[model samples]
Target: MMISSQKVKVDPRDAKLSMAHFYVAFTALALGGLAGLLQVLVRSGKVELPYGIGYYQVLTVHGVLLGLVLTTFFILGFQFAVISRTAGTLSNRARKTGWIGFWIMTIGTAMAAAMILLNEASVLFTFYAPLMAHPIFYTGLTLVVVGSWIAGGAMLTSYIRWRQHNPGKPSPLLSFMVVVNTLMWIVATIGVAATVLLQMLPWSLGLVDTIDVLISRTLFWYFGHPLVYFWLLPAYMCWYAIIPKIIGGKIFSDSLARMSFILFLLFSIPVGFHHQLMEPGIDPAWKFLQVILTFLVVIPSLMTAFSMFGTFEMYGRSQGATGLFGWLKKLPWGDARFVVPFIGMVAFIPAGAGGMVNASHQLNQVVHNTIWVTGHFHLTLATAVILTFFGISYWLVPHLTGRILTKKMNRLAIIQALTWAVGMTFMSGAMHAAGLLGAPRRSSFSTYGESAQAIEWIPYQIAQAVGGTILFIGIILVLYIFINLAFYAPKGEQEFPVGEVTDNAERTPMVFENWKLWIGITVVLILFAYTIPFIDMIQNAPPGSKGYKLW
Candidate 1:
């Protein structure tokens, strides 16, 4: 039987807690966006801030705030809402634990932000070892990770309680996805956790004289690629479980959706070495294996695309539209929530293709550390992930606040999405073009005494600045919409969209729900992928590098 669309109203306390998480997330978005604007302008050689804020500092702020802080807060809050509405109302103890996690994360964010602003932690978000920051910076980030762990624990506890009460029943798909994400996070973070606690934290505190850059980077990318999935899966959750309903259709296949998520859990972490394809310290054989694994992970993304198209086509035909492309016209283009995220998915098409290039050993040589890599991530993380977050915020803020998303605000949100699309197109396109022309990324200035090649980058640089300015304006509009939605909109209960399965007869396989089996396989894949390379690196490692603070 298809699951019903019933949604339990969130408890007022839970709503307040979720709102707190969102408020912090939006604040991070604003600050990071301003930093992004500064970056493009300064790099274009058009404007220079008189303040002590240098390029590296702004870059650090932009990366940490948006990439880490904003995503963490928003994901936690969205999952909380999903669990509360789908699984059951959280226990009082769980609610209390959630609040504690929030405070811990908030305090940690402040500590890290202070260090960055004071120029004590300009190591950048990558924080590649030997380019050290103050000890407090590492400590703060550790706390943030620990805080997320605590929050994940609370989510797990809630799911366990629900499972206990109802034996032999599949968990709600939304809660199931959240739990899977939580476990994936717990497993994936071990890499970065070890890197920080054993390596970076000690080295920063002067307890260690030097650290292995190769090993540290190995650990970072181990967590790093999966971290991209962590940002993505939540948006995918909405796409799989919610978007179909918004467009007047049910999910194409619940089984396929579950399997895709499970596959992601198994494959995401083991392929991190693909990011290091251009690095020499790693063996070529290991890199090739990772490149193969990287391609394997693409399967789930293709599955998602296929399922979404099928669902849209089914709905279109039901509405009497004819022809192969008729579904395109039937989609709810005017709905801010649907349209905004749909745009994000469209952006992912090229982002995913570019990723394959990055993973290719021969092809990566052209783009490594260039503006092309920066553009690729901007398309993936900045466009696909962040734009979906904006779409979620539109409905989510109102849902939590028990307020109506007024027509005027909805129109503004559509405009904001359009503006972002235009802005990112110009900026990221220019970045990719400039990269082909030998433009370096992360440089303070590109013009080196009128070198012709460097001079050729000027127009693209100007285009980037122009795009960034437009994007900043869109950010402001989104913040305004959120503020008004949370505090000033007319009070009303928001409908939580949950897409039902169209084929009720096709039950999800029991194997798809076997958590232990999936986890076991995931661990095995990770071990197989990393064991030899890590051991080889450690045993034959070169002398470690000491800290440097060039910035």
Candidate 2:
């Protein structure tokens, strides 16, 4: 059975809250997309800021708005809508909690963004310690995290209410996925929250003379790696449960989907050390252990890939298609809803491969801190995740707004997705090639005093500028689509696609809902992975350094 509130439409009140989030998310996309374009132009040495704007400043705006603010708002808003659709309308208390969380997050967003624009903070997305910002910047981001926690609490309350009402019956698949992602986010954030509240805030405010740099970075990565998964799982939600419906297919296995999510919640946190492999003070023994755990994550990723392929092939066969590759021809190539996310699905192949290379100690040494790393994340988050998000908006925004996606708009969306894919190919592809030739990531344009190797990177940088221009066009199309869908599309009901599991699929086990078991095992794994390394980092640490205001 498909999970639903048994309503033909999302409650208007619930949708109001969701639309509030969309307004902010698209706004962030516009500003951040422009910042990104400027960045590439600067790097290509084709343009310079006329009024003394710093490259790092633009970089911070791009990272914080797109990476932090936009993703969070969209995921939370989308999750809230799903919970309402699948479980039931959120109760008054839950709705209020969601509203409060949104405002707090919005206010914090302004604070942090203000600081970045004023050049008060340029620490980049990592916010590594010893590169301190004003206290309000940290405080603002803290509020963002706190607001998200409150929003997550709203989700938990809804999930718990569903379990209480439904008894032994299985939870809705969409609802269940939302719960898992929220739980994972809360767990993953503890590391970053601790670093900010206990470490960065104090040191920045003069409560501490010097900060422990190694510990700060370790704590951040503890949150950082899973943070990547946090961005991804929503895209996975669309792939697992939603995309099957979009392509006119049944979900391959409900139990398999739940199991993979459980596995992800377990494996995602303990493996942050893979990101820290290049840093000093970590033991090789522990790094090796974490690397092994990191590989365990690949199992769930493969499971997702298998499920997708199975869904596609089975649907094609049912449509009277034959032979090994006929399924490819059966898919809805003209439908933006399918093709856009399908593009994301294809991008993840290289994205996932690059991730594995980065996880290896020997291979990481080659690409670590290089533009290749930048290229890798751009494919994962920028191409794979963001494209999937745009695909969701094609139906979701219309469904919520009581509008139909005009055919013209649909064709435009397809063009938008292709433009983004092509742009990323040029930009990220150049980044990888240049990085292999020893080009660095995160630095602004320079001739490096005309060194031979530095000169090797210029052509690639120009390619990136060209790609950036194309991507900017893609962003504009998406924004125009959003505006039309929200206010100007012909008024009509649009269906929100939700996949039904195959009749032959095994029943979803109640064990998947044993919160005590899953959360307990997750805690155990995190403790086992980090306790020793953290103790080692602290006990024999070298003298700390005072904060730097490099920006």
Over 4 Å off, model 1: 1-3, 446-449, 544-551
Query: Which candidate wins on TM-score?
Result: 2
Clashing pairs in 1: none
- Worst 10-residue lDDT window for candidate 1 reads 542-551
Query: For model 1, how does the per-residue alpha-carbon lDDT over 89-145 read when each residue is reduced to its tens digit?
Result: 899999999999999989999999999999999988798877789988988998899
Off by over 4 Å in 2: 4-7, 447-449, 544-551
TM-score of each: 0.97, 0.98
Candidate 1 lDDT score relative to the true structure = 0.88
Q: Write the per-residue lDDT of candidate 2 for residues 27-61, one digit (tens) a residue.
A: 99999999999999998876888688889899999
